[model samples]
Target: MRHLALISGADANHTLDALFVNAPLRDYGLRPRTNDYTLPVLGMAYIATYAQRAGFNVGVLDAEALGLGIEETAQIVNGMAPRWAAMNLLAPTYEMSARIADKLNPQIALMVGGHHAKAMPDRILADPRMRHLKALVLGEGELRVAALLEDMQRRRELPGVLWRDPLIGSRAGGVADPQTSGQMLGPDIDTLPYVNRAFLPQDPYRAAPTPADRRLAASRGSDWLTAGAAHGHLEANIVGSRGCPYNCTFCGAAFSANPDVKIRVRSPRNIIGELDSLHDQYGVTAFRFVDDLFLGAKRVIDDQMAAFTQHRIGERYVWDATGRINVLDRCTDQELGTLVANGLREVALGIESGSDRILTAMDKRIDAEMTERVARRLVAHGIGVKGYFILGFPGESQEDLDATVRHIRNLWAIADQHPGDIRASVFEFRPYPGTPVWQTLIKNGYNPDELLAYGDVDLTQDGADESMRQRDEFNFSVGIQFGGVPLDVVRGTLALLTREQHERNHSGQEAAA
Candidate 1:
């Protein structure tokens, strides 16, 4: 059929990057209700649309939204009879993703991309069962993937691609020289097609965020589902920018990790235009901007907010975007107001830690003071704040843990007083190789194989544990303690922080003793 299948493989349902339903979790009486099932195409929509426009046939298989397990998903793709299947891969879900690849019809050639794939291409290709994985696309994959689809019918040299041929030997370009986004070769953000939703299931796009997200949002006057229902519309995830300028050690967005990465933003007109198309064509009124750096700087914030205001985006539709704690810390109350006035219902911050030591270790360049100032200022203006934290970092101390807990409590206190709500999205740290922290662990006699072992370990957890082992950390580290703190303290603190977030976000839960 000369068809290309763009697949978003299964991810741990517990974290923000989850694309698939957690059947294993739900089977054990865990919660993954209707709201959690459907999610917009992460980056596959762009690749699909771009390939389609380039005269290639592309099909989307969202395993998570379909609620199909590993075997069923493989069965369906085999029936589709695709010549090439390209997937976005992550470290934690490597096993699940690899399983899907293994079960695919051997006739279907595979290509992989995403940060994990970019960092660990050799490991993926070395798997004996992944023989079908012929190539790995690095960095922003829209153009690279389109080129791959065009070239896959017959092998030819292309920039930014690493492929292995059944006939020819393995090729270079995986690690050495893949260009990141916003380079001279990168596609213009404004001109790309609106991600062809026609390629994906429409119903999934119609659903709102998970229940916890909705509750926290409502606490801050940012309930997208209710607000969207008022206008007889639905919700979808959108992107305003690509790549990040920051070099936070825990993040792969650093330019050192990817070759020549640059942050790229769509023009205000282009962004507003997409909103209009989504509204009129797809019935989507509420949006969640999933940019790594949506609010780039004051100038960018002004330009986007000004354009959105001109288009009446605030009045007609609502949205939430990623924010920089350091950037917003410097923003004036009026500047924050400008963002709120332009339909920014809430801002998600990579607060990372409440302790300056941990924050400095992260290379986040923002401190607790900056975070508190930004959170307080934003909430005062009625904009929601979603603070994300990492537990058991590589070198965290007891004092650092105490500071983080205190900071989270302070954020909650701020939310309690204002119309804005705060959500502390905490995750146990897992050091992925190639990230700065991974190198630190390596210097400290840590083996990357240890993390790979976690990924390779049995994902099933005992019922005694409230949380599943197959979490986002499964790809990083399930529980090898890197920090000085003991494993018990780490888990206990994880439970404590997450439970508090649960009480605030879910509501109706009695306080824990």
Candidate 2:
């Protein structure tokens, strides 16, 4: 009998309604069909690789990719009849697992792991919905989970795994003394085995297994998707680095808690080598640098760019990445141009707020002037810049809100001043657990009990609309605000701001005439 089954029930993240949140489900087209395919999450693939390497019989059930509902996934798992079943836990999928656990109780030792499990162990343990879960793997789970399966096979205890006990509160069950593993970035990422994509149905919408599924079910070959034919040029998603140094308030807690571990990178040669294979085998040209801050370290970023320049893949491909505004500001004009020349076509710059006070409150270390300067410079270099802004920070006043509107207006003006240069995005603040702002909000009596309530507030609660309507000069507008800023207000603000920018452009044209 297969001792363990690394069952990843296909996930459907309907709760968040944001595509990136359910990451693997991103490839689904707007019209939701039963047969759309989603990219396999790299993390889950790594976990499956490590588990298989540890010598246990493992099978996968990717319900999300199959577009199977919870009941359908449970039926499949019941059919597989593995001794232990493992599921990944993200904030949005917590309820999904609860529903699955309710249906498949007492048959399998269900285990859950991921960011939500690591950050909120106490809460996860206490939730009655997940009480039936045999164990919850906390912290960096890939290596830890592999160790856990080995111990489970030997009838030894599992370390770092929380189990329910009637006599005492949830106690550590399984093996003792699990080896210490840092959340630091892993080494030689390219060496990890390719993900086993066979378990998921080829046509995710059809709810029918493919020939690949039969091959994976029978365990005929260890490398199921190695031929790279299944995933087109667009299916590849690679991470070259781990960690971010900056402490953006709204950023996820996993990143903020371990800031020093930020910017750890694999060798440029190794990264480039993988890129070449991905390009050759999978026909992948469009790549995304999935790091928190891709250009955090000057030396590493420069080295990677140098490699890109030497190899010159820019002729065929385009790429995008995320970075801090300060990083771009510090970059020389020549370096910025070099980056664009080497295929850095798009950047998501975290200019969290246009107001200096709010920026200081978040410890962002960037000002409006610096943001404008760097954004303009990126545009001049023929690189697209997307400015990220935040609203509804604590200690913000009406004046600060006005400043934000004005700041976005100035950016729109920049775009008009130099057409086809830059674009801007506005977002509201969502205080994640364990951030400095979260703690402050807690201390100041602001309740954050609702995980999905950040974007649901009524923005007019603070008379923000009156302030925005009173603005004398405007350009491009971004209408994201916390406290439930009305969607229409946001639209109107953006329209007003755009109209002002257009008037400015017309004035310039008339002067030329």
Q: How well is each residue in 1-513 modelled by candidate 1, as lDDT tens digits? A: 221233432221221111121211111112232323444565777777776787665667766555456776666667665667677776665666777778877777777777787788777767766777777776666766666666663224445567664565555553323444334236778888887766556432544343333433354465544554333337667888876777788877775676556567888888888888888886677788878767756777878877887777766676778888877887888877777666677788999899999998999888898888888888888888888889889889999988999999999998888767788877778766568777777788877777655432222222213233223222135568878888667666766676567556546223210
lDDT of each: 0.66, 0.55
* lDDT of candidate 1 at residue 443, scale 0 to 100: 88
The TM-score values for the models, in the order shown, are 0.82, 0.70
The TM-score that candidate 2 achieves is 0.70
Which regions in candidate 2 have their CA more than 4 angstroms from the true location?
A: 1-40, 53-82, 153-160, 173-191, 194-235, 253-256, 259-263, 419-421, 451-513
Q: Tell me how far candidate 2 lies from the true structure as C-alpha RMSD in angstroms.
A: 11.5
- Pairs of colliding residues, candidate 1: 20-64, 92-475
Segments in model 1 whose C-alpha atoms lie over 4 Å from true places = 1-35, 153-155, 165-185, 200-233, 455-476, 506-513
- Tell me the lDDT of model 2 at 324: 70
lDDT of 2 at 140: 45
